[model samples]
Target: MTPNILMTRIDNRLVHGQVGVTWANTLAANLVIVANDDVATDDVQQQLMKMVLPDTIGIRFFTIERTSQIIDKAAPHQKIFIVVKTPQDVLRLLENGVQLEQVNIGNMHYKEGKKQVAPTVSVDDADIEVFKKIKEFNVDLFVQGIPGEKKQDIFNLI
Candidate 1:
C-alpha cells in the first residue's frame, strides 16, 4: 500500500508558511509528512506546524525510521509530500530503501559555519559531503523555492 511520493524537499523550516500553503497546494498533496527526529518529539513544534497547515491536507510527523516504515504501508491513492530539515535526513531515508525519485532543496538558511550555495540554500562541509552522497544515489537533486521557479542542480554548487 505504498503511497506515491509526489515530492521530497529539504527545508530547515519544515512546515512553514510557504510549505504549508503554497507548496502543498502546488503539488496537490493529500498528505504532508514532516520527517525529522527532533521535531517529531517536540510538542510545541508539532502544534505550531499543525496550526498553519490547511485542513484539506493531512499532516504527520515521524523520525526517519518510522517514516520509512510508513512509506510501505501508505495508502495507494495517497499523494505524499515529504519535508525534512536537512540533506542528512534525506540520505537516511534513501539509505533505508525509500524510493525517492527526486529531491528539492527548498531552503537551508545560513548557519555559523555554513557557506551559501544558493540564495535560499547554505551548507556546511558535512552537508556538502552528504549532498555528494545523495547524488551518488542517482536521485535528482535541485533547488527551487516554489513551483515554476528555476531548479538549480545542487551538484553544480557543491
Candidate 2:
C-alpha cells in the first residue's frame, strides 16, 4: 500500500516519547511504520515501542525491506509515518523503490564517530553517503521536526 503521508523522520531513539506522542499526533498519522532491522527482529523491543504509541495508531515494524514492499504496492491512505533509524535505511527503501519524493528528518542524535548537524541531527560518513544515494532518486531531504520551522538540508551542509 502506498503510504498516505510519508514522513521520513530520523529519530535514533525511534518511537519514543517525542515521536510516539508529539510528532505522530502533529502529523495526524494513522499508520506508523518503523523501518529498522535491529528493532524489528527483537520482539521485546517491538512490543515495547508498540505500547508507547497511542492505541489509536496502527503500528507496524519493518526491517527496511518490508517497508519497500508495502509502500510499493500503492494503497489509499491518509497519513503514514515511516520512521527509519538511519539515512542508510532511507537509501535502502529508495533503492527498493519506495517512491518518496521528500524525506523529513526528525532526529539522529550523537553517537560514536558521528557528527552533529544541529542540536537535533547527527550523522557519520556512512549516513552522508546513503543520503547522497537518496539524492540520486531526487528526494528533498531536510532536517526539521514540525512544519513552519526553518529546515536545514544536511546534504547541503555536507
Best by TM-score: 1
Please write out the lDDT profile of model 2 over residues 21-76, one tens digit for every residue.
Answer: 78788888888888999988899989989888898988888788877777755358
* lDDT for each residue of candidate 1 in 1-158, tens digit (9 for 90 to 100): 55699999999899998999999999999999999999999999999999988899999999999998878889888899999999999999999989888999999989799889888999898998898898888899999998989988987887
Name the regions of candidate 1 deviating beyond 4 angstroms: none
Error of 2 at 154 (Å): 1.5
Task: lDDT for model 1, please.
Answer: 0.92
Work out the TM-score per prediction: 0.95, 0.87
